[model samples]
Target: MKAISYSRYGGPEVLEYGDLREPKVGPDSVLVKVRAAAVNPVDWKAREGYLDPVLDAVFPVVPGWDVAGVVVGLGASVTEYAVGDEVIGYVREDFLSRGTFAEYVGAPVRTLARKPRNLTWEEAAGLPLTGLTAYQVLVKALRVQRGETVLVHAAAGGVGSIAVQLARHLGARVIGTANERNHDYVRSLGGEPVTYGEGLAERVRGLAPEGVDAAFDTIGGDTLKVSAQLLVPEGRLVSIADGDVVSYGGRYSFVRPDADDLTRLAELAEQGVVSVHVFETFPLERAADAYRRNEEGGTRGKIVVTVAWDTAGPDA
Candidate 1:
């Protein structure tokens, strides 16, 4: 099978496209015929070896977190899905050491959810990582209620795009930060668009005047620092990026692969309660290029990698 991998962690240039053996199923895993996968900040960060502290990677690593695919075979112990179900999932971070950047990847049955019938694989591919992150942050971490004002930094981003829609759907008035170029796109996602760099706090004050009730902080550094000060007395601040803000305010690492959450997100996608926007798509052979684009930033939504597969063969 063709897959993207790096023998040593360094830059995107280290990624190589070549043939490798297909993964065998574990007792609780499903062998998925990869269709589409999305790139996240973690993909590039892992490629450059930045997450060595939290996740240990053995090289010849394939780094991707979001996967949309069809089940070609099932583990002996698995019963949630059959041999021909279509699904989408957040493959565990450790699994990315040999990830969805391949024609075939194995996902545990617990992580896989039926892909929404309304979306193409490309769109479904874009949802798992970002959609789940946004859902968990708003519905669980902050517990944002209707009529409250919520600020979402990097609002045009993969996670933020979904976050904005979910916040609005939950009845919060969402104030999103993006550059002038992405303001229209952010607004379409149901957020009030605002320029992000410098004087961001003042802009929020001018709009809401009473400060925000809560914030979903995706950008670290100055953004997180500033958001902390903007929170109301009992407001929440949750971040996905690495930083020390937990010592100062509300914080939670994204909730991983909760079957119930994935199921709910799938239903929302089908119902059009929210959408995952895909700004770019690449073939597995161009995995290096995909990571480079994600690192450049300013993207309005998720970037996906299409893993093209041939006809099914005998199962391993």
Candidate 2:
């Protein structure tokens, strides 16, 4: 099988495209013939060894977690899906290796969900991680309610865009921060746009007047600090980027794989309540380029890497 992998932790420069053995399907996993994979900041961060303390890295690591693909084979114990089923997964295992950047991935059933029929493979690939992050933070962590005003940091980026839509779906008024260029994009996602930096708190205050009922921060640093002040005295706040949010009486949320949650997100996509914007797409072999683009930041949506499979074999 052809895959992109690195034998050592480094930058995108370390990534190599070549043949590798196909992943094994365990009792609780299914083998997905990769159609497309999405690049998240965590992909590049993991490549740079930032997640080493928490995720064990094996040599020749394949670096991707979000995949939209077809099930080609299934484990003896797998019953949720079968051959020919199109699925999307956040295929993060307990260790770092055998990831979705390959022609195939052995995804545990817990990580798999039926891909939204309304989305293209690239868009479906983009949704699992970022969509789940937004859904979990707003719906579960912050418990945003109807008629509430909520603030989302980095609202034009992947997760924040989804957060904006989800908050609006829940009947909350969304105030989102982005650059001046993305202000209209944020508004299109149903958020009242506010430019980030220096006076973010004041801008949010002007939008909400009485302070926001909840805040979801995807950008760290002083943005989280600003979120703390923009919230009412007892408002809920959560950050996916900063752990120090705990110190500000807010929660730090790390996205986890939940088939039920992923299914709900798919439902939202199918219902036209939320949609993924693909900022760009690259061929599988050009994954390193995708990583470089993601690292450059300021992307309005997700970046996807498409895998072309030959009927005879993997990229035959």
Candidate 3:
């Protein structure tokens, strides 16, 4: 098998592509034939060692968390899926082992689910981590309600794009933050788009004169600081992209994968209530280029790395 890995953490340059041994499945794991993988900010953050303490990785880490692929094999105890089932999942982040960057990787059955029939491999690849994060933040952490005003910072980014759509589906008036370039894209997702950077509070205030009921901050630092002002008293404010929770005198949260939450997101995708927007796709060989584009931070939606599936099993 061919895999991209890093013996040490630093920059995109740390990622190396070469031949590697195939993964061995565990008693409770499934071995997926990697069709496509999603790249999130977390990928780059992990590459930079930002998750060192939490992930507790040894050297030579594989930096990808999202996988959308076909199951070629499963553990002996697995009953939920059989060989050749299409699936997608957010790999557990705390434990750092070989990730979705490889040709084949082992994933626990609990974290994996049936892929939405409506999405392509590339699009489905982009959904797991970002979609789960958005669903958990809005539906669980924030407890968003119908007819309430919800503000999402960095709304055109990976997680933000889904958060905006999910909020709209839940009957909230969605307001999203992006730059002027992506305002139209955000609006298409059922959000009143506001340009982020500088006076974000005022821009949101103009849209929500009554004050926002909740906020989902995907970009931390100043964005998290500014998001605090958009909420009404006791309103929920959660940041998942941050390494640490921001204390904003409201509900701060970290995204955790629950089987139920992923099922709901899949249901929404199945019903056409939410759309997975994939902005770019790169071959696994061009992962460095993908990282450069994601670092630019102007993408309208998610970026993904599509592992080639045309050739397989040491023959290509």
Candidate 4:
């Protein structure tokens, strides 16, 4: 099968488009005929060895986590889906080898969910990882409540965009930090936008003088620190970007692949309670360019890689 892979950790330059052997499906996994994959910062970070401390990289690594595809074959022990089922998944494992940036992927049932029928392939591919991050952090980690004022950093980015919408649905008033250009975009997502940097704390205070009831920090470093200070007494805080959040009396969250959670997100998507924005997309062979675009940052949403499958074969 054709896939994007790298033998050694480096920049996007390390990525190669070539043929790799088909994945062997386990009893709990299914073989998905890949339609589209989304590029997350983690994809490029993992490519550069930044996540080496946690995730083991099996060399010749195929790097991608979010996918929307169709089930071509079911595992012997699987009863949840049929051969023609369309699905979306956060197709990650403890190790990196076989991944979603390929013509096909062996995705475990634990990470798969029926795709939202209303979404385009690229939008469905963009939803899994980022949507889960926002859902888990808001619903579980932050325990955001109705009528609370919550602040989200990087409001126009993938996770923050979803966070704003979900929080509003949960009855919370959202305050999001974004550039001047994205203020209207954030407002469209149901957030009151505040310009980041310098007087960020003052700007947030201008919106909620009593201080926010919860804060979701997507940018680490100084932004995380500012979020810590913006909270009301005992206000909740969580960070997916930095583990140091624990030091500020906040929790550090890492999104895990859970079929139940993914299903809920899909339901919400189909119901129009949430949506994904595709900032851009590239063909599978130009996946390296997608990585480069993601690394450049400031994208409003996900960058996707699409596979042009042929009835002829994998290479075609």
Q: Which candidate comes out best when scored by lDDT?
A: 4
Q: Write the per-residue lDDT of candidate 1 for residues 69-107, one digit (tens) a residue.
A: 989888999989988899999887443475888888888
Per-candidate Cα lDDT values, in order, are: 0.86, 0.92, 0.83, 0.94
Candidate 3 whole-model C-alpha lDDT, 0 to 1: 0.83
The Cα error of candidate 1 at residue 271, in Å, is 0.3
Give me the displacement of residue 266 in model 3, in angstroms.
Answer: 1.3
Q: Model 3: per-residue lDDT, tens digit, 80-171?
A: 88988998988775766678888888888877888999999988888888898888889878989999999998888888899999999999
> Candidate 4, TM-score vs. the true structure?
0.98
C-alpha-based local distance difference test score of model 2: 0.92
Off by over 4 Å in 4: 312-316
Which scores greater on lDDT, model 1 or model 2? 2
Against the hidden true structure, what lDDT does model 4 obtain?
Answer: 0.94
TM-score-wise, the better of 3 and 4 is: 4
Candidate 2 stretches with Cα past 4 Å from truth are 313-316
Q: What ranking emerges by lDDT with the best candidate at the front?
A: 4, 2, 1, 3
